[model samples]
Target: MTTANLHAPLGAVSVLRLVDGIMNFKTNLVEWNESRQTRKALSQLSAAQLEDIGVTRADIDKL
Candidate 1:
């Protein structure tokens, strides 16, 4: 095969790898941000509210 034809599949593979990396990064970021927000909101709750949900102050601080 010609050099040009050989490089075509390699370039396509590289592009696919890059797209996969971007998608994985985005999924991880979204999950991280959601967990951070949940922790922050839980931290803002009163001790009684937390206890009602079975969470302690120590648990909130740990998050």
Candidate 2:
């Protein structure tokens, strides 16, 4: 990126890059939250329930 000069103004390119970065960040954050929630729900299941799905308690963290 070029340095912002006193005589030069920012262009639409810089604005678009910033907006794209913000959107990517927001999407990653949402995915992380959903994954945590799914892990929590899986942890709440009983051994039998987990077995029915072929998952063991020790496998929760690996997921």
Candidate 3:
């Protein structure tokens, strides 16, 4: 079996992981914002408008 080097600097790996986590957070935030906007717009629609789009008031919250 090969001996592992325990003294290696893991700065690069740690930085990459941190960047990945930040990017994931940003992506999720954007998606959530978009979903919120969609929900808001749907909620503002009249019954007839919602019916025209084949969506109901209950569906808005489900989305």
Candidate closest to the true structure, highest lDDT: 3
Instruction: State model 3's lDDT.
Output: 0.94
Q: What is the TM-score of each candidate against the true structure?
A: 0.73, 0.73, 0.80
Tens digits of lDDT, candidate 2, 1-63 = 887666535676788889999999999999989888988999999999999999998889876
True-vs-predicted CA distance for residue 2, candidate 3, Å: 19
- Model 3 has how many clashing residue pairs? 0
Instruction: Write model 3 residue lDDT over 26-51, tens digit each, in one string.
Output: 99999999999999999999999999
- What range of 10 consecutive residues in model 2 has the weakest lDDT sum? 4-13
Local error of candidate 3 at residue 13 (angstroms)? 1.1
lDDT of 2 at 58: 85
Ten residues in sequence with the least summed lDDT for candidate 1:
1-10
| Runs off by more than 4 Å, candidate 3 | 1-9
Cα distance off (Å), candidate 3, residue 25: 0.4
TM-score pick, better of 2 and 3? 3
TM-score: model 2 vs. ground truth: 0.73
